[model samples]
Target: MDDRKKNKEAEKVTITPSDESTSEKGHLFGLDETIESIKDAISDFESGKILNIAIIAPSYAGKSVLVDEIVNIYSHEVTKVSFSSIITDKEEIPLSEDQSKIMIFDNCHYLYMRKIGGFEVLHAFLNMVLEQDARLCISTWNIHSWNYLGRVLDIRKYFPVQIKIPPLNSSQMKEFLLSEYEDGEILFVNDVEAEDKQIFHVVKKPLAEKATHGRIKLYTLKVNYVALRSLLMNKGTPDETAESIIIKEITRISRGNPGVAKKLWKKWLEYPIIKTSNIDKFSPSINIDVDSRFILYLILSMGYIKKCELNNIMNWKCSVDDIRINMILFELLNQELIQINDEYYSIRADKLHLVTKYLEDCRLVW
Candidate 1:
């Protein structure tokens, strides 16, 4: 076997779709409203309303799962196809003949480009949708791709029914994450876990400060990140349960992303007995240059990427020089924003929030 294949496989996570939350089926715990909205939209489609739905969300926000659910619901009518990367042509996409039918294209971002003028397939698909009859098409897109396309092609105008998946609220996030566990089955350790507990009150420099702190007003109750986490956790409250508090903090940090929240919870639960105090303390902010951020985005979009494929991804994006990209990757490794085992690279489960937030602010992620 090749040395690359001989190396270990990347870590994996397993989720039970059937063990979904109370609100919605599957892992989409807090998306009852969205599901309802989608059903209503589909009903309109059935009525020949011809509503084209664009489900805009970030990676691992259950975009595929949501579409899959809708497909299962309308299996007799909807035809679904999934894409992973750039698609130059629409030859492979099957068009529906029935005017009242539904067509679903997941990862529809594959049709557009970030730079400019490279989306012939997207244009063709839009043309097909517009020129055709009363049939409805439902497509999913990365928030970043959708934003870029909005500016480039005004794509939102076409998707009259845009279902932007909002982050799950505290209650919804709690139910979603805890759905897998039986009542009080998981015992949590009631203490904050940190490498060093010493405090730092100094004003951070632009390098570190810019990434973590957005606004600053002197003596305006500037709170340290760790301290703020401590404050929001509702610690020592007789009424609040540790599990609820932990889920609240996780939802806050994860911004209601089910995948990120689940991964964070798994990482925190290093042992069978959950024993982590301040969940926020686990979130670490790391600074990165432009090249590094680009690399991080690629890995995140794909969720987990092969270590050997780093150069391929960088080149695909036409990123920095190979040597420089290697240097940035090494720096990322040093920062522990990502983990490498065998021949795969992945974002550290705890750092999902930090990474997602950074990309979101840049308007790069969904």
Candidate 2:
């Protein structure tokens, strides 16, 4: 393999360990390319020139994992310091030659706003990197926020080399599943392996449905692959007589969020005989601003809310016009917090659960 390919292999191995005991399968999937590019970039830094690399993508695109892997691989060769949010002057951790080697700031997108002194700590840190000329600073952020920060911070002239980590495409998703699951051969029985698509499309139907009234869909296979690997490792795979229904059900619940998938999968192992229908009991509702409640309620009610029903429900309490609801709904969709198609709006269930719960506790659920 070429040096690039070799680096990719190293990145892959670092993500999923050969020994199943210590691995979190989520790390292994959807990152080799980005990691390889980052390693190569780090190599450039080691040769004496400083480089500020940015990892930009949508939320939950695994930016943190990418940074962690790169930091781990080049721990000794470079100095690594990381941050997630805006740094206050008092909270600022100075980056010095002795303390600074390769700096990895996890969420540089948080530095856009002006605080007392305006991202004072981040400004100082970046200036330090510029003056020192020996530090390599790699940072990650949601692409939208990154764009705003880039414009505000004049990031173009400062950190010219930006690397964008695209979300997991279908092909990457399949590879991720195979690497995580033992029955990789069986799971991908047809040409369409679990990793066959960028997003794993699984139905989100309630148990009693023969034909989904209005189906909810999730990329559960990809989301929960890492969590599933961990859970399966704990319980041991089923024998010939054992069923794989639990695996499918667990994946469905995860809807492709690693954190949620892992949590739900772990809970599943504790009680393996649970039914898919019972999964609903384990789910939670999220709380968001009341202005955004109508659409959210529609989503929580299982991805399809009739316009007439929504209007009737709202008419009982508030007079939110259709235009207002439509506007806020569009905004949420843009944020990837919700998805709408064919006159139906569906909450990104993963985010909805948490946001809804918060709103309810705050008594803001509309």
Candidate 3:
């Protein structure tokens, strides 16, 4: 393999659940209440009441990490089966004749597709869950897919206990990111000057109507509303440290999603030190046709998918061939909206929210 392909493989290995131990996976930063709820549901299941759980969260928001933590808690009894691609048939599911009473299915959103006749496998799986009175099923789903399925199939009824992962606050984010490091091991540098860090800036834009044949420039003052709000909220706190500021900015940019925050942390960190100016502030604007939008939605829904899997989904849903799918993937990769690692494509971590918002605006995703 080429160097780029090797790097992609390495990244895939790093993020793979099997490659990391329970402690190395992720800290349950803001999920204490969620964990407690799942534990209660498990207890009820053990007591003859099969209270199945559906853990819902957006992609890269630590759905798998949460599932891993749950499995660790019930290591002796829980059996976890994580899906990395769509399951076109019910038989593809790995629910074996195991003695374990608790079954954890991660990425349960893969059970169905958005196309016609797509719910057959999911219906079958649900039926199986209903028939298996002795087994308790705990499934996880992409929030968008769960919403769509809820509207269409009323899937929420199948899972009695629904747990939505909550976003972490600034302090929680700091603790989660710093959990892997020793105290004072990592440095937070505020390299930008105070004046440079102002919440408002002047920008030049092209005039809507030019006075002459030549182009005209218009100067306007633009305010960073998010930064302004942060400043206003922290106005009374003058003793805040650079670490606090960096974590706050990270929490703001990542929208408190732990996976995104972790990726941002990796991007900004330069060994033991990270600077405020290194934080990513650039947002990619997505403007694509309906077909591309649907493809993007598929990637977001599945989390990580191979090109062949995309081809299969497109063939079933839209009758689009591999070449056209490749073109669309190329366009998305060029736009930095999606990335490929070891032939598996997923929404770029930094662009996850941006792509989801765009899809929502287009009504492609709920």
- Count clashing residue pairs in model 3: 0
The true-structure Cα RMSD of candidate 2 reads 15.5
lDDT of 3: 0.79
Give the better candidate number (2 or 3) by TM-score. 3
How many angstroms is residue 199 displaced in model 3 relative to the true structure, after the best TM-score fit?
A: 4.0
- Using alpha carbons, what is the TM-score of model 2? 0.47
Output the worst ten-in-a-row residue range by lDDT, candidate 1: 6-15
Off by over 4 Å in 3: 1-26, 207-215, 316-320
**Which wins on lDDT, candidate 1 or candidate 3?**
3
**Which digits, one per residue and each the tens of the lDDT, describe model 1 over residues 1-366?**
111232123111112232331123556566668879999998887777877889988655777667756765666666655654455456744454443367777777766544345577788888887875666788888776677678768998889999988898888877777788888777866564343232344443343466647454333223356545555554565455556667777887787888778887887775546654535454556678777887887666544455445565444444446567668778988987887755567677667667878887776664
User: Which ten contiguous residues of candidate 2 have the minimum total lDDT?
Assistant: 1-10
User: What are the per-residue Cα lDDT tens digits for candidate 2 across 155-179?
Assistant: 6566767787754443444344344
The segments of candidate 2 whose C-alpha lies over 4 angstroms from its true place after superposition are 1-26, 84-86, 97-100, 110-117, 184-349, 352-366
Candidates sorted on lDDT, descending? 3, 1, 2
